[model samples]
Target: MAELYSRRSFLAGALTAGMLSTSAGYFFTRRNKIQLTLATGADPTGGRQLLVSMWNRLNPNVQIQVREVNSSTQDQFLKFNETHADIFNLDVIHIPRFAAEGKIVPIELENDISLVAPVRRVCERTGTDQLWAVPFNSDVGMMFRRVTDKRADAPVTLKSVLAASATGPVTFAGQLDTVGRQTDEAFVCNVLEHALAQDEAILDEGGVLSYGLGQWRDALAPLADAIRRKRVVAAAGEDDTARAFQRDSLRYMRNWPVRYLPLDRAERARPDTAEIRIDRLPLGILGGQSLAVAADSDYRDEAVRAIHFLTDNPAQKLLTSFGFAPTSVDAYIDADLQEALPHLSLVRYAVEGSRPRPIHANYAEFARRFADHTRRHLHDGEELTQQFITDIRSVLR
Candidate 1:
């Protein structure tokens, strides 16, 4: 009877081991086949699709699904919270707020130091050494003028820009003509770029608001005079300005490098018609999206791998071909890229010196208040009173 009991126990132990081996095999198989979800703003040129296809060819086991969200930062943030996608792209300015809320997961990139210095600098949380996102693509404010004009050495200063405008058609999207709140932020960006170029500090060392109403008014006065004299065509936004420039209605404009892609293609086709020349802005505003992983994502490892794949050298080169400026320094220096992007050197210079927007948890509120008051001052002839300064201070608080 004892022998029979010992044999039964041995058989039971063998059955348990068999079951464990089958479970392990199933787990490993599931781990090898991961599906990742990515949320990003609409890309009309199918660039995002092409990028995903390239990624899939390199990584055959992982599949990526893309979802299109609203272009606004606030809307994207809302979607991030609601969907909890494995990965999401956000504007650099939004990094601080998201980090403060603990919504994003910090990642350790192997080549973090190799990215463009200014672009890499803004990925960290303010007043701390923690990094929250990876730089994907970047844009800066640049001057676009007709190549044939050759007037005033490309307007190195705001004064020079105004002086050149006096000679020919110069238009900017500096108007506060919109009834809705849509154009307010663009107006503020234009103002900040001009102010920074003149060495005016918008925030002090301690990150408190420092630029006074008087200083801002002084910086904007020249543009105001041009608008009044009909020397500057004040459009509503960059799209309007680009369209006007395309139709040969304007000789000079301030726009992003992405806007130059179509113009470049057109010039290539014509080869004899007017071509556009781009140069560094007096001060360029840093603009671009950063990739962040979700803290609660089920596929964190896969998501990180995807981020690395997208930011790798080859992927960055592809991004430039799609009219997006890559953050990788190598991509900027590639000879083929320089030939394709005639303004590559100027872009590199701008990226190196570009000024980051204000970093604060309540930055959205601050921007809204600043834009509202500035627009009112520009359009309604309202005074930049002490009360206005006080209101801005309250919003920052």
Candidate 2:
């Protein structure tokens, strides 16, 4: 459970960035020089120095620097708004807020704009018809398997998780503290999608409220029951889950693969422990990241170039090399890359079926309401589900 902050409070914090570094030089340059700063997630090999190197190689006159922001920071929007940065690696849901505030520039996604249709559709759903961002490093939740569990079988649904728990230990990142954070948010999104899949209308034609209470109730009941019954252990952290999996104490777990990258197979095995396996987040649901330009940037043209270079097939393939699932629709079909990453099909399904987080101007507020409600139900013994839906509706409204 990362510390929660109200949307208003986060906005207020934007007024407190006098400590941020000032622009190195005026935007005016002799040779079309554009100074761009990119705010990226905390992944060391992701959207970091590599993007700067690649962009510089493609556009020598452009100066782009990468700034690392702790993914857990609720005040990330504030930092984006206050920075001298011209570009950003923003989340899809958070983009609306910055766009609504006139702090982000909408991108002009030309030159085969369809490269990332799923990302584009998400912006359209948010009523941001103009491209508000570019695709940086993209990702999706992947299902992992312990190598020893050679049953040659893997569970791929809510029902499977519940059933697996009955036979052996299942661990999940269940701490309420991790709820509002992006990884945890993705976890919850999967839960919501699993619930919505049971209903035909998952999301309305307008892509607003989902209206299938009965199915949602049924879909989530097993998860709640498992948590309450001690058949499943809720880890306070992802590391805890990883540790348990390493000890052969965990038969199954759900989280992004980045957490597992730091561990080698030998360290993860207890003599007979087989290598862990990777697959996309369960079908019918997916979650990941997108890159957007700051509305306030004076360097939109140059920013667009940088965005393009980063998301194009060549760069996307480069990202794949770094363990990030490429967002490009075509990358999944690349024979060589697919061979290198055997789970490309699963990743493709997760990204294609993926839905962005609620893309409202007040997204943080909505996230808070949803997180609180989920925490109450999953942890506090709040057995009521429909009432929780009502509470969410009130806040969202």
Candidate 3:
């Protein structure tokens, strides 16, 4: 057996070699007891634990060993390389890179999986025309406001949000404070959402990089004006905005559904607190995780079975109980789940309309460069000068 390297080292080698070896053989012996190792990020909501329990109940002969990995995708990949875990859970955006590197094996479905069309699309590897991962939970950005607000209608667009804010009926907050290339991922996500709302494309169908320079300017101009006028509260990240909203200092916020879980709990505990109302963003970025079987795993069969068990209708419903949006279309319409999660319809709308970030082997590099320039543009008060635009274009190329 060859030694596994860290994700960074493996990526470097893969880039140089143009491909990774996927010839590892799987050998399984029939036994009374079977064990599988699963590598995944730490779950605060205990959703993974519930899945493990369900799987164990269904297959008493098999036991799963869960190993918690880092939250960072790169760090999770590093753990995956070192452990060669039977099953690896990772972000949907990483599917392209991991599949290209041959770190994850393409999954063959014995029966059709009921994943929403958008979520299913993200799991497919364009280059190989294979399904690289099984969609577990899906997310998309949405606008949240207090239920007590007197607004006659929801802010359906960025222009509407700004207009509402200008009238003093509501104050808007978003993740806009960019520190450096190290700017918050939410900030970068927000920028992409803004651009996409205007029908912009960062990369075309052929995977060629292109900077929608004009679209960037058009999207940011109104947001900049709003920030200047102090109608939109510019916060560092989601937490900051959430805190402000909780204090009734801000009337509207753009954030992920996960943020709502806690706020909803707080509202239930204290009716005096801001009761939240959710609505889909006119456009937003999709965010979520998927499960993939490692190419080098010793328990490929067991791993695939585990992924299937996790994504099944019952398990997906359990996931929604943990505040995760389900990838299954049926889960969105389930009567019981709909009663528990009143925002299910709004979430379904957002997920259907949301777009995934650009998928490419070099996406990590592209995201870093995009964040760096957008941060400078938004925070440093740098005008989108011709030279600066050229620099942005150069980074994408």
Identify the candidate with maximal lDDT.
Answer: 3
| lDDT minimum window of 10 residues, candidate 2 | 15-24
For model 2, the superposed segments whose C-alpha errors exceed 4 Å read: 1-34, 57-60, 71-74, 113-116, 125-129, 149-152, 171-187, 193-207, 211-215, 236-240, 247-249, 257-270, 281-285, 385-387
Residue-level lDDT tens digits of model 2 in 3-107: 211322332233122111221221224475656888776765543465566456545577788777665434567766666666777766676677778877666
Which candidate would rank higher by TM-score, 1 or 2? Answer: 1
RMSD of 1: 15.0
Compute each candidate's TM-score over C-alphas. 0.83, 0.79, 0.82
Estimate, for each residue in 1-397, the C-alpha lDDT of model 1 and write its tens digit. Answer: 2343344345334433433343221122234677778878777655556767656655557788887776554344566667758888887867877888988888877553368877877887555665688887888878776655445434455557676677765554333233344555566667676656554576332334564777767766766566666676666667666776666545567777777766655653543445667778756777888889988789887788788767666666667766677788987887766765667888888878777777776777777777777667666667677777887788666
lDDT, residue 329, model 2: 73
| Number of residue pairs clashing in candidate 3, backbone atoms closer than 3 angstroms, sequence gap of 3 or more or interchain | 0
lDDT of each: 0.67, 0.57, 0.69
Q: List the candidate 3 regions with Cα displacement exceeding 4 Å.
A: 1-32, 73-83, 127-129, 149-156, 166-170, 178-183, 198-210, 228-230, 268-274, 385-397
At residue 292, candidate 3 shows an lDDT of 92
Off by over 4 Å in 1: 1-32, 125-130, 149-157, 164-182, 203-209, 267-273
Report the candidate with higher TM-score, 2 versus 3.
3
| Cα misplacement distance, residue 34 of candidate 1 (Å) | 3.3
The alpha-carbon deviation from the true structure for residue 58 of candidate 1, after best TM-score superposition, in angstroms, is 3.4
